[model samples]
Target: MDLLRRRAEAVPRGVATAAPIFADRADNAELHDVEGRRFVDFAGGIAVLNVGHRHPRVIAAVADQMARFTHTAFQVVAYEPYVALAERLNGLAPFSGPAKTIFLTTGAEAVENAVKVARAATGRSAVIAFTGGFHGRTAMTSALTGKVYPYKAAFGPMPPEIYHVPFPAPALGVTVEDSLRALAFLFAADVPANRVAAIIIEPVQGEGGFHVAPFALLRELRALCDRHGILLIADEVQSGFARTGRMFGIEHSGVEPDLVTVAKSLAGGFPLSGLIGRAEIMDRVEPGGLGGTYGGSPIACAAALAVLDVIEEEGLIARADAIGERLSARIADYAASNAMAPIANLRGLGAMVGFDILDAAREAPDGLRARQVCARALNEGLILLNCGVQGETIRILVPLTASDAIIDEGLDMLAAALAE
Candidate 1:
């Protein structure tokens, strides 16, 4: 209670936390508050802890790096860990041919740098994004994001030449054809195809509610970009690493993008983001054109290296698939039951799962009741989050490193919350 009061006074209201509990410690898929109460972490720190909280390997890597040196600033004094991580990411790039990578501190930085690189490569100023898609909270990303109310509200006048088309979410009554037609209309009426520099999309929409991009739409986008000379950028900020049963979500579509923005789970829990792109496009930016003071922090690089090792050694990609199957089966059972709230539309790729609370009529989204379920689940000692344009989604971002028992326990809490 005192901590809550202190938080209310010290923090700005704009930076909202999903739960009021203050973390004392966390391990794997569980967190303990200062009050010594435990909570099953279904949120995974908003998809940043795929390897789980404070994994021994990640901690050791950071500690080792610290013992060597904390920071000389990669830009000022180059570090081996940064270069090694970049090389590792480049080799793991989803696209064919030679690839390159540049590290940053946040998903937003990777996305913004992607746009800059795209513009430099294509010599065009306009960029395209999809409705209901979330890139980031930065001014440029906010303009790119499709949602209004919170992300873009009262923030304008936004930067110029950032346009959005409807994302094909059938549940939301926006079909793939509808999305394609809107893009056609956008080209004819709003911005010409030739003037567009890039079309950025999340292979699986994260903040827009775990909607997996239709492979058909991805193929069409690839063809359109090919014909128009526009770069296709896959923003894997929330869906990267092993969260989607693949190293990157775009891997599911089999439609290679020119550039990929990766973060969230990249460095386990460390603040490390990066852009992996084609060698030619990446080289478009001149020397010293791209970098940050703490862009590739040695500490974060060490952690990220350990994270990659963990993903491979732990077989997390396959584990993501197994976890997804388990989650989907359980959520489906809940949806079939009359005892639970009107929940439907359980969707996701791999372990990145989400379902929506609907009205009694089973039609429109029930944001209020969804909020209620999240609150109830929190009271039940499970941390959950809601997304989608209407805040009607219950997203499950459990760590891949989580044990089956932990996942089942979290799901059981979810069932109780739904019953309430």
Candidate 2:
């Protein structure tokens, strides 16, 4: 706690609320601290290390790029890696028409740029986002984010005209029709639909919980957006890259979004994000309307290219489905057994899985108990993350590359923690 406490004082207080573990090194799906304590990494750097930690291919790519050049500021002198990476992303995205890709440094940048592009194309000022969706921390993204406690606590006076509606969860008593009703209500009560430029969502909410948006709901949203001329933006920062079985989370419904924002595991660990959209729509932003000094760093682009190679060669998308099936079955077994606290409303797609902790009476959500279980799991050498509107659900985002032994060990720790 000494180093962490010091960090709290030196760094902005808002940036330090997660688990206090200070990692020294990591590999595959295991992390070691300064004191040499080993823990199975179920968090995967908040789902950024899909290729696992310190992947050999990613390491070689970065090392090889570093030997040649680290920075040239894509705006000044263009690089081949950036162009090639964008080409790959454009082809891989779910869009049927010709697509264009723009690289950025983080998910928030991609999101902000996507919005800018949407506004530019539609000439509208308002945007709609769903509650429980986690966008990012930038001023505009903070405004776009649906959760209130941590993301919007002190940050207020957020960008205006960003309306929020309920995200559907049938297990939680909200249906697709309910979501549609909310959207209709928003337009009638809050803002007019014609003024809305875009509606962005996480196909599987990240910080909100691993709730998969229903297929019917996504299709309806797409239809609504199409009819109303509102662009559909899918924020795939946490659910992208084989995390949800499909390369993109939106693929679960077989619907195509006008724009898709991707980051997190896109570069396997490097800081890189991209906005992929229809070529005609993406071209709305003029030459200088989109871009940043470090938007497409050469090193990050090289690492992303390597990540694509690894995903293809390793068949990670298929592996994600298998992993999720196994994990869901194990969780279902634990839920059936009364050995640990009851897991209610267990749901997810692919490797993104979550279950809510039930109350002592085994009825309602027990948020405090969920936090305790996460803490105990961490102490017992397993890493887990808690989510949900009230923080009552536990979500697992283990690397697609993690082995069966590691996954089982992490689950055992979780079971023990719940029992305690």
Candidate 3:
């Protein structure tokens, strides 16, 4: 209550909080509020805590780096951790041939830099994104994002030359064919293929919903980019780092992205984002063209290296699959139950699961009920979140390191919330 009061006075209203509780501490998959109440964390800090809150390995890495040095501003005095981390990411790049990675401070920077790289490589100024896809919060990314209400509302005069086509979501009445046709139309109508720099997409839409991109759509996009000399960028900011069962979500479709924007869980909980691209395209930018003063902090790089180690050593990729199965099964049972509110459209890849709350008639999405479920889940000591075009999706992002018992406990709370 005191913290809420202080926050009301100090913080801007534009920054909304999903829950009013203040975090006192957090463990692998649980958080304790300042009031000393415990809650199961199913949100995973908006897909940024796949390794969970304060993993010992990440903490130790950060502490060790702190003991050595915090920041030298990689641009001023290139550090080893940054280079080593970039090397690891490059080796893990989803595409074939030599790859290169440049670290940045946030997902937006990685995405924005990716556009810059694409334009530099292709000598084109226009970019294409999909409806229901979210790239970032920056001006350029906001223009790239398809959603309107909150992300773009009142933020008038978005940057030009960013086009959006329909994303294939059957529930939304947009089919793969519809999306492809729209793309073709976009090429002919708004911008020509030759003038387009790149087409950026999330292999699995995050803020739009946990809808997995159809492999057919990806294949078509790849072919289109190939024929037109446009780059294909995979924005893995929310779907990367083992949250999608694979190391990178785009790997699921066997469609290699020319450039991948990665953030969120890249450094466990640290603020570290990176853009990995084919070596030739990456080198298109001159020496002084890329980099930020705090682009690759030594502490974040150390944490990211440790995060990579944790993902490999802990078998988190496989763990993500198991967690997804458990969540899907439970949600499937909920859909069958008349005791719960109408729920439909359970979808996701790996553990990045989402289901929509629907009207009692099952004819339409029920954003109100979805919000109520989240509210009830919070009251029941479970931290949950909603997404999708209509805000009717309940996305489950519990940590991969979470124990089965913790996962089940969170699900039980979720069930109770749905019943209410």
| Local accuracy by lDDT, each model | 0.95, 0.91, 0.95
TM-score of each: 0.99, 0.98, 0.99
Where does candidate 2 clash, by residue pair? none
Every model: Cα RMSD to truth: 0.7, 1.1, 0.7
Residues 1-420 of candidate 1 have per-residue lDDT tens digits of: 999999999999899998989999999999999999999999999999999999999999999999999988888999899899989999999999999999999999999999999999999999999999999999999999989979978886889999999999777888899999999999999999999999999999999989999999999999999999999999999999999999999999899999999989989888999999999999999999999988988999999999999999999999999999999999999999999999888999999999999988888999899999999999999999999999999999999999999999999999999994
lDDT of 3: 0.95
lDDT of 3 by residue, 1-420 (tens): 788899999999989999989999999999999899999999999999999999999999999999999988888888899989989999999999999999999999999999999999999999999999998889999999989978899888999899999999877888999999999898888888999999999999999988889999999999999999999999999999999999999999999999999999999889999999999999999988999988988999999999999999999999999999999999999999999989889999999999999988998998888999999999999999999888999999999999999999999999999993
Weakest 10 consecutive residues of candidate 3 by summed lDDT: 70-79
Where does the lowest 10-residue lDDT sum fall in candidate 1?
A: 149-158
Model 2 poorest 10 in a row by lDDT: 12-21
lDDT by residue (tens digit), candidate 2, 260-372: 99999999888999999999999998898889989888999999999999999999999999889988988898898877887888898999999999888988888898988
Model 2 vs. true fold: TM: 0.98
At residue 384, what lDDT does model 1 achieve?
A: 97
Off by over 4 Å in 1: none
Per the 3 Å backbone cut-off, how many clashing residue pairs does candidate 3 have? 0
Error (Å) of candidate 2 at residue 214 is: 0.9
